[model samples]
Target: MRPFLASCLGAACTAALALPPAPAAARPADPSGPVAGPEASRASDLPGGTQSLPLEHLVPAAPGAPAQDMAAPQGGAVHELAPRTVRPFSLVGIVWDDVAVALRGRVQIRTRGRADGRWSGWQDLQNEKSDDAPDPGAAEGLGSAAHGSTAPLWVGASDAVQVRLTLADPHRAALAVPHGLRLELVDPGPDTPAARTAPATTPEATASSAANAPLAPLGATEIPAADQAAAQADVTAAGGAAPAAPVHIGARPRIVTRAGWGADEKLREARFVYTRNVRAVFVHHSATGNNYTCAETPSVIRGLYRYHVKSSHWRDIGYNFLIDKCGSIYEGRAGGVAKPVLGAHTLGFNNDSTGIALLGSFGKTAPPRAALEALGRLTAWKLGLHGADPRGRTAMTSTGGNLYRKGRVVEQHVISGHRDGFKTECPGTLLYADLPSVRQAAARLQGR
Candidate 1:
């Protein structure tokens, strides 16, 4: 059984203990980050038809761990390996960065035992906020720090894993995806079996229910399966691993939203829709404590928009995508989000920004760990397909359109936040602090 984390209010984490705490873990007051903990996000099917690491749903183990040897990475990496029995199993890996002494990121430990080909799933060892993702404390800023992280993962033998990581500096990407840290396979302790492992999954009932409910396709036509290949071709030509850049991506390839003609759904602090052809991503936080499941998000969005558009008199939902406290990504604001038009969310940077509204104001909230990883995976996939450089200073600079900051407006082609081009905390202050990590992650996947 997996562990279900309950203490996480937004992004709070409760780390488990081990013998002689690692040097970094012993460091006091990471006011900006969550300490490491014991967790296993099994990849088997769970309840939501999608998979989220069920925190607190742990299978209790015996005390008294095994003897082990720690293999440290050459650089600022904390690499350690132990047999499932020899060491008290928990998530493990290296700390990437700690800007402002609060904001931190890491190229986490992945794969319980990969080099030796033990059957363990890839485990991201990012010390994430216990609730959603990178739940930055008050000392911690926001953005990726609030929702994303670079912690390593812990897995057993007999699993194959792919490690994905992002760096804190725009200049240097995490070595995890490439070679930030290395893994050494050890014998599974005397107790656990070395069977193969996969990532977690959502419940079928919930997944089916969400699918049956039937929401409208984002404002654009669904990229047909045949065209999916074409879309890939276009992306490859644009400067990805191939040559094309993938400029578009639909949400959760597993679930398909059909196109419909109707009014938008009501959301929790805003009225919104998820349609159109959005081009770039502008990230934000919801700052709420409620945890959300993917199946329950449509109604949440519906109620939110009712407040924002109708109650607040906004044109549409401020964000195009709402990442819930449980790490689910919901659609918002249809017209501009679906299209590449500028938005009201960012100042002087809406023209091409596709605002992804995280379900809480990160300055005060923590998102789910799944949410952060999902964002990383999604962002990487999207940017890779589009050939957009998350950290690249250069842009097409040819978008001749009206952009705006605080609704004042301007024209731009880069993907940025409200603070970058404007003078307001539209995306919140903490989010700006982690943009570098976000962009760096995206840059690595640009045009895949």
Candidate 2:
């Protein structure tokens, strides 16, 4: 029975593991720049019911005054009622064209609803926080750092919108506004109730459950390779003691897929599936605020989804899975949760691994115990599938980065924090300090 199972599953798994990781140059450049004043610079009909509206129609350089300095005007600037026809957009984000220019100010957005002509209250969009790690595929002279606009804010369903930017220091007004401001409108796909139900089982979590039997206990006696021939002969002659129930290393936990959180499927571009053997799990904190309740998680996810896709212009969410402070896990990126879907979370080493980001920033505060436990359960389940030891050290080849030069081999914990691979304070100082405990808990779950 052991030989039969091995023959059935080994080949596929071997091929997957032997495959080489893709080069860093393969990642696409982030789309930046938005037209601050209406007139829409260029209207692009994008995939997934998303539209890109560039600020082509800028406040025309005052009747030909050499393009009005492209730099942001001094003091507070308000663009009331964007100069575009109202459309049915459920999500919105700000984008820019330059990578070097950093905007410093408070950005507030308010949208007009079609139903009652009422405008939504001003919503604060988070400014772009410094990510110590450089972006993958950064061009010459462009450091690995991620340079873009602030994270998006959820505005529910709306037609019209307005935005205001107030510079913190008027002295910095000399800095240009980058190329322009772009507003992305995303249409949440069909609201089909039937398609929104929670999945009873996911690929990884259900692997053991669906078999309807406890796995063979670990440490079961193993026959030497030289004795396998005789063992197989015996198994063929007599159905060999029904392969002592396969070892059950760890149990999978309940997870919420992007769909489970009512994600707008149309916001992200078509799924980009890249397969790799799960060698390590990198932990990270979303670096967003923590003043949210469990009920508002879905809303928070929507905002993040829009930001990652529309604003950052990535293929999908940077993390493979997101865990809220309440311990709820939500699937990220548009691929099978069980697969080693490469993420953009860790700049230099995103291949052959998985990224799990806690939903809130933990720079000063420690992560909740519940969140830590969920992290353990998740890594235990994910890594166990690939026969990886969570507490062990492993080596991964860096695709490239500022922290570790391209093609260099780097060692990491089976369960590590984002800072382990890059020079960033990601995963936060407090949360990163807790990784040792996380590794221990995961190993315990794996019965290591």
Candidate 3:
């Protein structure tokens, strides 16, 4: 019992570390489409109950017109897919081939509501602030990194969709047409009315209750064999057994699995890929807006999963886990929640880390205390499994990016905000500011 107590409790700790930080903002209004036309014919099956239609395959608005480059197409390309009905799909999004090409323009979309049979007003898709690496705009074949996309916008219960791309600022644009454009339709499965009436519990309440359990004071990030040896020595020094070294049990939060959220696992193209040791955890905010209830969170996650895998073309959901404003922890990606599942959340460093995303945009509002505490508890358990101290720093070689060029060796905290690795206000300013406290709380959980 003493040895078990020390191995688990001596394994978690933390410290403070700082690192670097994207810009792009232009709002588009409800730009209506010409008409509700037929759905495009170039549809490809994607892993999760979704389909992708390439812009290149879409015929021009007027017959006989040559295909235009998406960036600066003549008079701004306004192509629409012929309208075709399908099973009630609930989400739509745009996918592009290049991440580096910053278009000085707006991309808008509209969907035919399944219930009304009427097309919704044109809605803009965000082109800036991508969470994945850049895609090469190649002609022959897409490069390994040549897939990027916008955050999927929720369009409730839709059956048809149409899209248009326009260069708002023609002069300063990259002067290149978008090599490829794709639209995706995702079905989040039939609504689970029961989800609305489900009971809510403090996700970390069980862990918090055992907060007073005893633990070895572990200040260092590394919990080597010497610590265990010392614990045994302490027991010997205290008569027969050191009062059973009160075992400090760290409880895991009640995580909602992908199935619990009604995810169509078959839609995923392949099984999850695992990485080696998880050296760090990157915290991020979805930046997808904060207008949602705890009940609507699963729907939001399903949309993001479709956006990431189907539209963005990533291997899986970028984060290993997700947290809602209500402090619920969700097992993100399909891999075993306990494994070192590589995630695509932080660019250039996805292989050695795990990403924990808070489910809403936190740029303006401070993250809920519950959400922050959930993060702390999450890191405590995750990092502890790897014998890492949450308060300490570790080195990782960046594949390269705007902040740290490729092949750069950067030292980051075991628990880091997304900005620490990439140049983005990712976890949000208010949330980034809360990271220090998160590290401290995690350390305390480890008895550091």
Candidate 4:
């Protein structure tokens, strides 16, 4: 009740807020465009190759990165869904300066397809995981006028998705749970018995809550205190922000592995996982860095049976989560996810690929910039939860830098570097030439 900070592994990790409070504002824009219950059809509707990204072209850092100086953003609008249904996604998280915080979870999206059709890959999409957003709403105050909320996460579809939010352990180090998280795609609206109890709050609801990011609560530096009935049932969860951070998954979840083809070769490759729902996101780079984080790190099934039954026979331990230069993000496939699953660590490309391994060797070195700006704001909050489209396309053919040739479609291709979609290099060339400064420092942290 007074800017807390210290709990265990339930959530709200670094708790702190409680200053003067009440003086920030900026929680109004769901004019049905950020993503929620159907409607969204615009963007001309898409079909002839479909390509349009602009959350300010999802930038965060890619040119001399430092988050490219910070400040100068205001571009986020997506609405184009109806690719034939099949959902189980979310990437919601919130965090401002003083109040309003929520971090509903669920982000283990790893579904892949293409095998009898042409040998596909990637799997592990069991129940995904969600159930805790009970109140999560409140903010509008905290230094620099703290007012920034958008941690959305829906996971169904959005032009090749890729999201990673691994921060387990007393909020990982300097503490920062949801400095604002967004990832859209809900649209369940109807009442249906209060949508089966309530939690998706607004922006549409259906399919319980999930974790991995979009966390905004507290009491975890060692246990700050407050179980007042699970923070009063999360105060109607899934909607709130305006504090700093609180992702209390503190030490005790560090065993994650993924290499796949097992389970009897995934039932002989279940006829290519999805068939036609994946679009683009093949980034890679586990170029070997070793492994291990803090807050305990050990839950992806004991880190994938110690990398496939004690280090190599080729089983688990590829890249679904690894980041450790000290920015913390350790959880690699014993599950793997981000919806519509399938990931092995890039080849013909893990069907969709949401892998993230960064232990070291960036072709020699260059890895930590606050752990690449916290993995480029956790990959721009999972490409704003799959509505992916942060604009980035410019090449009239006149001497260049990124090359840009293959098909050429822009609107949602961000914070990439694993040699920008396979060729072997892996996050090399000093981290794939610093993916345009970490995708423009995570699209200026959501102003793209």
**TM-score of every candidate relative to the true structure:** 0.38, 0.59, 0.65, 0.21
Q: Compared to the true structure, candidate 4 yields what TM-score?
A: 0.21
Q: Would you give me the overall lDDT of model 1?
A: 0.34
**Higher-TM-score candidate among 1 and 3?**
3
- Expressed as tens digits, the lDDT of each residue in 376-401 for candidate 4 is 65554444334343234222211111
Q: Please report the candidate that would top lDDT against the real structure.
A: 3
Which structure is stronger by TM-score: 2 or 4?
A: 2
Model 2 has how many clashing residue pairs? 20
Per-residue lDDT of candidate 2, residues 222-333 (tens digit):
1112121222222211112333434323566666655466554444444445545778999988765575677667666655665575556565667888899889888776
Model 1, position 32, has a per-residue lDDT of 18
Model 1, poorest ten-residue lDDT window? 192-201
Model 2 is weakest, by summed lDDT over 10 consecutive residues, at: 217-226
**Candidate 2, 125: how far from true, in Å?**
7.1
**How much is the lDDT of residue 231 in candidate 3?**
34
> Candidate 3 versus the native: TM-score?
0.65
Worst 10 residues of 4 by lDDT: 126-135
For model 4, what is the C-alpha lDDT against the true structure? 0.31
Cα misplacement distance, residue 69 of candidate 1 (Å): 55
Off by over 4 Å in 2: 1-94, 98-147, 151-177, 181-248
